[model samples]
Target: MTHLFDPLTLRGVTFRNRIGVAPMCQYSAAEDARPTEWHLAHLLQRSLGGAGLVCVEATGVLPEGRITPTCLGLWNDAQESSHARLAQAIARGGAVPGIQLAHAGRKASRRPTWQRGPAEPGWEIVGPSAAAFGDYATPHALTPEEIEALPKAFADSARRAVRAGYGFVELHGAHGYLLHQFLSPLSNMRNDAWGGDFAGRSRLVLDTSDAIRAVIPDQMPLFVRLSHTDWVAGGWDTEETVALSRLLKAKGVDLISVTSGGLDHRQKIDLVPLYQVPGAEAVRQGAEIPVAAVGLITTPEEAQAVVAEGRADMVLLARAVLRNPYWPAQAAIALGRPEALVPPQYDRGWNDWGKLPVELAVAEPMPAL
Candidate 1:
């Protein structure tokens, strides 16, 4: 049985352990959608905290794709140059640098959440259909020609990710993003080649995976984050997610990082610990694909069992890590596997970790560009 601290390798890249810091947006980018200093300090600390991987936030693949005007982006050379520094800093801190390529669709161009009440849309948004996510502005339905162009846009971002020194790349198909807008029946009402059936709905993501895999070296893994369910009746569900995962595996995709329910404001989720693991487990077993379980998995025991019981291949954390950036090392100590807290950092509290196999830093993987 694989434990939480066990190393996991996908394609040719190796993670020091199975605990990854889930990509959580800081919404602190510059006006041009470039990552600011906050993005660097925020992620590099998680790397040093002993996370196996630290994924960058949901970055816009195009200007209009941003969730907020301040969200990170990857469409240009300057952005790539800026991100290279982030990737290198995370690598030096002993974690694999990964990025989530995203387009927020109808959810784009809102005020940052910290701004609180009644955030209005700053720009026109696009979606699989004109259906809006509750009170957000109704989006323009993308034409067939626009649909055909998106895969290359994602592919171009993947190419830039390689050039930026990201060792892992994930397509953000979850949490009511552009790809999720196409997958869920409640949001995507199109009858054209881009919508209607499962095959049609899946085309954008499949084409995107194909495009991204074509450019990135075989050594790097491509992950897709899937919203396991839309949580409303007659919406996207586990069965469809399983089928999609199988096809994704055949397309040379490495893993599914399972999350759920951001496509609709009408979604009725019963929030609790491990609420979404079953979804991840279903995708892993039914599809016979590796999956990373996310959503409310907040405890060490819960995270350990997810991997050890063969329920999921990896356990990703968000709020848990945000509350404690060194949750990985702390979990190691709690599990009586205290070696992860070693190297006797000059920090006073960590000195009593007793004896441990001081880990040498992992060498940076060759840049794919």
Candidate 2:
């Protein structure tokens, strides 16, 4: 049985614990689409708080891939340098640095939640089909030529991530992003070789993974985040997600982070704790692959149960960690592990009931090809 406190290794990267900080969009980048001080501060604090891995938010691979105007990007040299700083900061703060590369598809060009009104003009929004996502901006249908070129765009971003020193790379194929748009029948209505059947629809993500895997070091782990179900009838479902996970595993994906809904506005998701754990377990068993469970995992006990019971290999915390940056340290005390989280400077506050070895070191992965 895997304990939540046990270190989890994927390829050459070793997380200090099963607890990971899920990427949350800061939406604080400037017009240049580079990391701002906010990103470094936010991510570093979480890393210092004792999370094993700190994944940067969904970043645009191309300028137009951004969901909002201020979202981060990795396409340019400046952005790559900025990301390098963020990645190194994470490592120094005691966590493996990770990044999620994404394209928002029809969902691009929308305003951030903090912002209001229609999206400002002069941005191109593209998707698998020319359809719009609910009341969002209508998108131009990507030509097959453009679609074929997308894998390279993603691969190029992966290459930059390698140089930027990210230990883990995740393709954001969920939450109605561009890749999810292709997977869901509701979004991808094309009749070409790029669409229609399951194989055709899944081509982009697979190709992107293959391209990245081929270029990155053999030791670096790659993860894929998938919306296990669209939660609407006839949309992408858990059955297909399981099937896809199998294929992704065969294609060199190390883990599948499972969550559901977010494909369509009509999606009807049940509100319950651990509602998505079953889906994660299904993919893990059905595909015989390592899986990360995310959703309403709020407490340390809940997180420990998910791992100890073999439902998921990891539990990613977003809102919980945001609520308390040192949740991992607190969890350590609750779970009877040593108070190995706080740094020497803050050691005086924590009770010294026991001691557990927690190394703030990341395994050295080979340089990118």
**lDDT at position 15, candidate 2:** 94
lDDT tens readout by residue for model 1, 1-369: 898989999989999889999999998999888888898888988887888999999999999998988899999999999999999988877889999999999999888888843235477899999888898889999999998999999999999999999999999999999999998889899998888999999989899999999999999999999999999999999999999999999999999999999988889999989899999999999989889998898888999998999999999999999998888877887776654433235344564465443433344353443
lDDT of 1 at 109: 82
| Candidate 2 residue lDDT tens string, 103-145 | 9988888788788545687487899998888887789999988
Local distance difference test scores for all models: 0.89, 0.89
CA displacement after TM-score superposition, residue 303 of candidate 1 (Å): 0.9
List runs of model 1 lying over 4 Å from the truth: 117-121, 340-343, 352-369
Score candidate 1 by TM-score against the native: 0.94
Global Cα lDDT for candidate 2: 0.89
Clash totals in order = 0, 0
